[model samples]
Target: MLRMNINNLIKIFFLLVILSIEIGQSLIPLDRYSTSSILIDKKLFFFGGETVHNLKPSTTLDQILYLDVSKPFNTVNPPFEELPNTIPFGSSYAIAFPSSQKNVIYLFGGITVNVNTDLDDFKSILHSYNLETNQWTIPTTSGIAPGRRREISGVINNNTGKFYAFGGLSDQFTGTPNNTIALNDMNIFDINTLAWSKGSTINAPLPRADYTATLLSNGIIVFIGGRETNAFRDVDINQLALYDTKVDKWSLMTARGVTMENRFLHSAVLTPDERIIIFGGRKVPNDDPVLNQLAVLNTKMTPYEWSIPQVPAIDNMPLTTSAHSATLVGNYMFINFGQITPITNPQIQLPFFYILDIRNFTWIIQFEPEKSTIDTTSVNKSPSNSTSNSPDLPVEKSDNGKQIGIILGTVGLSIGIGIVVGFLGYKYYKKQKYKHAIPTAGSPTI
Candidate 1:
């Protein structure tokens, strides 16, 4: 009978093992996706980005490659493929403004040249690509555009069909010392009417390049840190300002994370929660600018507040870097491809990739990877007539992130169970060992 009982337990254990393996087959996680690209509206897009080795120049790609993010995970699906090389300004920080002027993507000022030692090699021209046609077209409008610049932001008032941009570094004349014109001017492009209009300036407006300004859903434009125009030396500004589109007025808003660190060429992503997530930018020394600290702000509250829940997370040198591209797909934030200028070693921004899922926003260092949820109802955007390709989201950690997580979890759980089972067994064993040894009234002791 005892042998039969043991045989029954063994059969049950094997059956459960087979069932768990079957269940795991249906669980496909996001980390398994190997593409280092980001997704918007279920469409994944990526181009070659900044690499480390600063002294060596990098290439600027002109094609936009995409994959459908909403598809079910399958081993047979093709990954990201180029969507005809038509879009202009495939460089970093090209001012991707969605919900702007009937859903258009604008490519603006960024470095077309990486001469290493020279700061004069920035581009000033602005280009826009129509998503419907997959074509790049320059705006035919009027204004003294501070072209060949960087650190500019574009926001669209879709209701008015007006797309606006302000603040960048560009010298209008045959001059030196790039993108520092001290012009705190506003330029707006009317996509519906196809025209340009310069905005009136705020009183005592500070000149800033490498600063960040984002248009909120409430139609308020908020600008963050940049190099100030206080020419007396040893003075860099980290002030916050705002512009209201409805009222056409600009003002300052007090915010945290405005430390002396200059946050130029960094990215500010408005999360699904309406909080802005900032990523790598250079921290300038002694008022000499550039920084890599990322600061997120919860500006939804009156008297806006900044949040840097993940600071000094990247445990590498040049801790805060600039000219990197970062975006949020789902709950995770993707930061990759940027330039880094070390104090002595000529600027080299290595091609580093990071995946910051929303859960890790509280504990970023131990960023655990999660599996992708297979929602059959989700609409994926493959080419209309072609089978959707599955370009995977990069697994920023080791390929074993998922496997390691499972191992750790199983070990942790098994250890816990073992401790409980051992304690119970010890109680049972001791009960049997000393059951007859108890000092009871009826027991005889020798």
Candidate 2:
């Protein structure tokens, strides 16, 4: 009877071990696209984008979703939580940044498109989201707000507490059609005074939207890769332009490394090492977009050269993604929610989040690579019939993420089971010894 009981316990324990492995495999979340994310107070905040199933009228997300970065990998319950107060307007393609003030972040300029007419009701409104208060407040400003625009990128000067807005589309292409003009004009918002002022644009980069701007340690805002026209056939600008806030001068930087792609809507982040890490974007839609690569600029160097590190296969980054938000936290860049391809398919949205370790160049997916339920509806865009002769890059093998997660989980669980088994065994032996010491029930008094 004792042998049978022990065998059954061992079998049940192994069964539980298998069940845990399965549960750990299902932790990864579905893919997301066309959203904005920011890291504030060690937490990642994601807002405003169309989900896979709810793409009709291009449903903009108002709910603020967040992930706690301090938790261990794959162990947090309630993977994402919604804030009590939502964004005033459900918008997509909006720019979000952390302000110099603690526990405060600013969101500006996103487009709400009409599904029936395919037009953008663009907004240039600025709303301050207080992480501490869990409230969104539209602070009144004195200066003229930039006219309705989308895809405009901005950087807040922490030193001056001023927000700078660069080139963006002033008018939606609906009314003017092909005559839509990209604004090269710069707008400044004084956070302290709550006023707006026009910044010097004497020699700014060509007026363009969908380009990225990053603030350098020397107070220069670097702009790169935006198209002159919305047409995919139109080549994107390749020059790396620099704007000096101190002198109010604009000039192009002469970079010396591998010829970087002239693409727009791509995201860039300033690494702790002072290098600008530019990831996936395309020169034109429908062409094989840049993939699984990092074009890094050594801004610390005199001439600012670009270098692509030879990372190992295990350290391979995720495949091509654009319109995504890459927020830096500690030593890792949390990249979640963005378009993975230039060509849109109603059925092809991947909503998973990834973490790129800046120190080791390894990629980690936060959730399982399962396809989430999304609107399998086609998005209307200016079509590009162009095809690329360049070879296709390798897709991300998500199995690696799954395998690594499983190994770690299995090891950790095994250690826990071993400890439990040893404890139970010792208890069982003690119980048997106590029974034997009873001296056949009646003889125990001796």
TM-score of each: 0.58, 0.69
Model 2, stretches more than 4 Å misplaced? Answer: 1-31, 55-57, 75-78, 99-102, 113-124, 172-179, 229-238, 285-287, 315-317, 345-347, 365-446
Q: Look at candidate 2 and tell me the lDDT of residue 277.
A: 79
Give the alpha carbon lDDT tens digit for every residue of 297-334 in model 2.
88887778877866556633565777777777666666
| Per-model CA lDDT versus the true structure | 0.52, 0.65
Q: Which candidate number would show the highest TM-score if scored against the true structure?
A: 2
List candidate 1 stretches off by more than 4 Å.
Answer: 1-40, 44-93, 98-104, 111-124, 130-134, 142-148, 175-180, 230-238, 256-260, 285-292, 310-319, 341-349, 359-446
Per-residue error (Å), model 1, residue 3: 50
What is the model-wide C-alpha lDDT for candidate 2?
A: 0.65
lDDT of 1 by residue, 291-321 (tens): 4355667877767776556433444323444
